[model samples]
Target: MYVYLSKIVPLFLMPLGLIIFAAVLVLLLLVTGRRRLAAWLLSFTVLLLWLAAMPIVAGSLYGRLESRFPPEPLARIPVSSCIVVLGGAVGLPFAPRQDIELTEAVDRVYKAVQLYREGKANRVFVAAGNQPRSESGPSEAALIGELLVEWGVPADAIQLEGRSRNTRENAVNIKPMLEATGCDRSLLVTSAAHMQRALASFKEVGLYAYPVSTDVRAIRRTEYTAMDFLPDAHALAMTSDAIREWMGQKVYQWNGWN
Candidate 1:
């Protein structure tokens, strides 16, 4: 239930949806001859919303939230039951090409494989659940598992937790397996940008999962420049992800996950 709610909150909070309502309101206000008031208020509101999303305006906010946890050291190996990699890639069967492929989230699997190869963890658990809307339509875990196999991590060394639909559910569902296997702790593999929320969610469920973050997005820099302020879809997506993780952290805290 909580996992489903996490997916919905972002749609409403991001203002992508609310912008339509605000635009209609602005037009109605203008049509009624309150042009001056509408113009002033609308301009102010739009400016504020844009500013809220502007990377410069929100960079520090994202930085603070992202910095709550540092990236795990690549050289340091931790003891664990298994390295748990969270799912982000979805199988796309609707495309003209039919072969399975890696999506952006596949980095999570790659990092897990690297760790396993380095002997950081003896076993790997891919937590990929079903995305009903997907095309190839298998649980993300299955897709990642195949990738791991191709990468030469033997099939017997990998466990699939394909029942989880989201991070919260991933944590909820993986707990019993962890206990049953007599594993006390494990390294959690995910994007560096999303490690904070993932760790918090798992810990909330009483799992002591250490974070091994991959796919880092933010870089620390003292020099500010014009390009940093420019709006780019790729940058906006990263910023949005940062904000979503921060918001998820707050929600998890409210649920006593922290």
Candidate 2:
């Protein structure tokens, strides 16, 4: 139920969705002869859109999330502990290619491999499942495992937990696997923005996962340029992601899943 709702709810909360909603409301008010209300709604919507596109606003929102957990150096991660890499790093393949395609969160997989090569962890676990509407193909975990093998990690050193569909499910499903392997502690690899919720979910399931955040989105700017204040679609997208993480944390807490 949570998984299904999560996938659906975000569509209505993001910037595009909010803009559409506001537009519809304004149309309704104008049709009802409430011109004053319509004008107010239009202005509010435009202001929101402008704010959402500002780089400074996007950076600050994303920074709050990505900074929740500082990146852990590979050398400092416990040696021989299991390294668990969460999903959201890969997209479903559109067509067969020579290699699997990775998304912005590819840092999760690469960091996991680096942990293994540095001898910080003897085993790497890729926790991801097939996309909900995806057609036949290996799951995300399997695809990442293949990449690990290509990167010189032993095939036997990698484990696949490809049944989880979200962070909560990832924790619930991976618990049994960890227990079976006597892995009481693990190095958790995921996007820096998602680490807070991921850590909370794992804790709820009784796993003490040491955070090794990846794919950090927040950046510190030493000087602001003219372009810094310009409206950017990418900034809006980043803001949406940060808002989603914030909401995820709140919802997880409310449901006692974290």
Candidate 3:
């Protein structure tokens, strides 16, 4: 439910949605002709306000979620029964061998497999559930699990959490599967920028999992120029992800998840 609401809210909050509202307001002003200038100004103001709230500006307005889960030496943590991998981003929807492709979130799946093989966890959990808006038809966890099998990891070694529709549900739904597999605690894998919310959601359910973040967002580009300011849709997408995660974190805290 949380995931569904979050995905839908953005359609009404972002620049595109606001642009439509602006156009309607502008049309209203032109039709009324009584306060044309004032109406135009109001419409433009609303558009500008929505743009300002875009995630591209502040990378979620809470800075990057990196510091919250710093890199820990693998040796520092104890091995567990399973390593949980949360899925979000998916590769091209219609690729012939789509399961093999990797996206920002898929990097966590690969990392989870590596951790499992390295003795960090005896089993791997792929939490690939997604909301209805997901363009990729397959549950992310299932796809990654297939990829893992293709990469030589036995199907028996993986636990796919495909029913969860959001982070909160990911935690809630995975509990029974983990219990069935005798996995009390496991490493939680996800993009570094999303670790804060993911961990909090799981923690809220009384499931303590170690953070193992991948798909870091910070760019170390030496050249910072006009392109940074220009609107790149991909950048906007990443920004939205960061912002959504931050919003999720706030929601979790408010719900006493922390």
Candidate 4:
């Protein structure tokens, strides 16, 4: 239920959603002979959209979330009992594509494989499952497990907790398995922007996880070009992602899962 709500509610609260809502309201007001109020609302909505699409504003907003957890250097990564790799790094296989499609967060899979090869963790625990309760395709964890085996990690060394649909479910479902395997401490691999909430969720479930942040989106320098001030679609998307994470954190806290 929480997963469904998170997916639906955010569409009405994010920048683009709010702009669309305002535009529709403005149209309604204008049709009702409320030109003065409609004009003001339309102007405000346009200005808000412009600001949200600027690279400088979006970068700063995303930076704050990504910077909450720094990536652990490969050489300095601590050894742990297991490596827990969360899902959302791959797209489910669809028609015309027989293989699992990797997404921006594929770094999570690569980092987990690297840790296993480096002997940082004796086993890899993949926490993911199919959505819509699919019965025909492999779960995300199963595909990741296959990838690990192809990369030379023994099949026996990989564990699949393929029943979780979200971060909180991942923590709740994986904790018991980890405990059963005597793996109280594990390296948690996920995107840098999502690390804080993921960590908090695991901690709330009484699991001790060392963060191995991947797919960092924060800029390191203060340098900016003229184009940075201009409106961009990519910038707007990044801002939306940041806003979603912020809302996710708040929701997780409220649910006592973080």
- For each of the candidates, the C-alpha root-mean-square deviation to the true structure, in angstroms, is 2.5, 1.5, 3.7, 1.5
State the RMSD for candidate 3.
3.7
Ranking by lDDT: 4, 2, 1, 3
Give every collision pair in model 2: none
What tens digits encode model 1's per-residue C-alpha lDDT throughout 27-83?
Answer: 899999999888887887676557556667556665666576656667875766778
- What is the TM-score of each predicted model, taking all chains together? 0.87, 0.95, 0.79, 0.95
User: Whose TM-score is higher: candidate 1's or candidate 2's?
Assistant: 2
Q: 1 or 2, which is superior by lDDT?
A: 2
Q: Tens-digit lDDT track for model 2 on 108-127?
A: 88898889888887988889
Cα lDDT listed for each candidate = 0.75, 0.87, 0.71, 0.90
> Residue-wise lDDT of candidate 4 within 157-238, one digit each (tens)?
9999888888999999999899999998899999999999999999998999999999987577668888998999989999
Q: What is the lDDT of residue 248 in candidate 2?
A: 89
Best by lDDT: 4
lDDT score of residue 41 within candidate 3: 68
Shift in Å, residue 99, candidate 3: 5.4
